[model samples]
Target: MYTTLLHQYQLTLSSRNALFDYCETVKPEDLLKPLATINNESMASLLLHVANCYVFWLANSVMQEKHAYFKGDEHLDLTAVRNVYGQVDLLMNEFLNHFKDSLDVPLLITRPDGSQLTRSPFEIFTHAITHEFHHKGQVVNMSRQLGYTPVDTDVVRE
Candidate 1:
């Protein structure tokens, strides 16, 4: 189970990098363009949300086992958004590396509604990666609608 979890984590990390690279290639101007039909958020907004989610989950949920994800207002700065993403990526990598030898240890996570559950650290790691992928799909679709070619972020190919 530990080996399988580690492999999943590695694959997820690769997939995340692929998605980030794809996002980075998008033009800065197009990132803020509004969608015509759907009231979808701008690419920059989505990216910012993703970064913020990562930080909140890592700091409060994963590391501290606290239920609440974030406690702040939305950020609208592109450079700050990028920096947040970079920092979360580095922190996630560091955490994974540190726990590589303790994959079997379970983590206790508390819910915002006051529920408690236990999961392996590997499972929490996988959840974080997959959560990002779920949101990255939205960004990819938004990128396509904004007249940009979205990079192929298929996990199997990466």
Candidate 2:
């Protein structure tokens, strides 16, 4: 379980990096192109949200044992959002290095509604990565709909 979870996290990181690279090649003006008529978030917004979610899960939830990261009025911008992704990625790598030998250590987590749950550090890591993948798929579809080339990020299909 530990090894499999670690591998998944690694793959998620690679996929995310690939997606970001592909997005970076896109014209800045193109990022704001309307992709959908209803419930549409720009490509930039989607990318920013993914990064924010990761940082929130890592800093507020996993590391500090606080509630979810965002409150009501958290100021978010593209540069800050991108920085969060890089920060969380580095933090996760450092964490895995330190805890690889003791992957069974239980992590105490506090839910949004003030509930408590216990899970292995591996499990929390797994959740974070999978969550990013889910959002990335949405961004990909939106990109295609907007006539942008979606990032080829599928681990198996790429």
Candidate 3:
């Protein structure tokens, strides 16, 4: 079961990479284009937001480690986003290495609103992965609004 969960998480990561690759093809000037989203978050902000969610859940909340993921503005270019992605990727590896054996153990996970809930490591892992895919869809929509078409990043893609 743990291996299966890990596999699912890896699939999410793979798809995320594909999404980033597609985004990289976007023109540099388009990176900060304001999307029609409610909050007016640009493509770069959306990307950075997704990237920071990983660090927030895995490093800040789950592992209880002080890992920082973002080092640039929301209008950051794709290259800066890529740099932050590498940092968050390393933090995720550390998160998995530290908690892989504790999948079934209950840990206090915190929500974005500062509320806390107790959940197993596996559950939290699944949430984080799904959360990324959910936001990825939003990113794809935003990309379309910015005049770029993104390929499918679904886990089941052939």
Can you give the TM-score per candidate against the true fold?
0.69, 0.72, 0.86
Model 1 TM-score? 0.69
Q: Any runs in candidate 3 off by more than 4 Å, and if so which?
A: 110-114
TM-score, prediction 2: 0.72
Cα shift from native, residue 158, model 1 (Å): 8.3
lDDT of 3 at 59: 79
lDDT of 2 by residue, 1-158 (tens): 55675687778878877777777766666665546652666666666666666666665666763434432123243455466566667767765675677667887878668998887767767677777788788777776776777757977654
Prediction 3 global C-alpha lDDT: 0.76
Higher-ranked by lDDT: 1 or 2: 1
**Regarding lDDT, does 1 or 3 come out ahead?**
3
Shift of residue 107 alpha carbon in model 1, Å: 2.4
Number of the predicted model whose lDDT against the real structure is largest: 3
Q: For residues 99-131, what per-residue lDDT tens digits would candidate 1 score against the true structure?
A: 678756887877667788887767777677777
Per-residue accuracy of model 3 over 1-158 as CA lDDT, tens digit each: 65676677678778978888888888877767776573777777777887788888887888877766674464378777877877767776776677778888999877768899898877767777778788788878887887777888787786
Full ranking by lDDT: 3, 1, 2
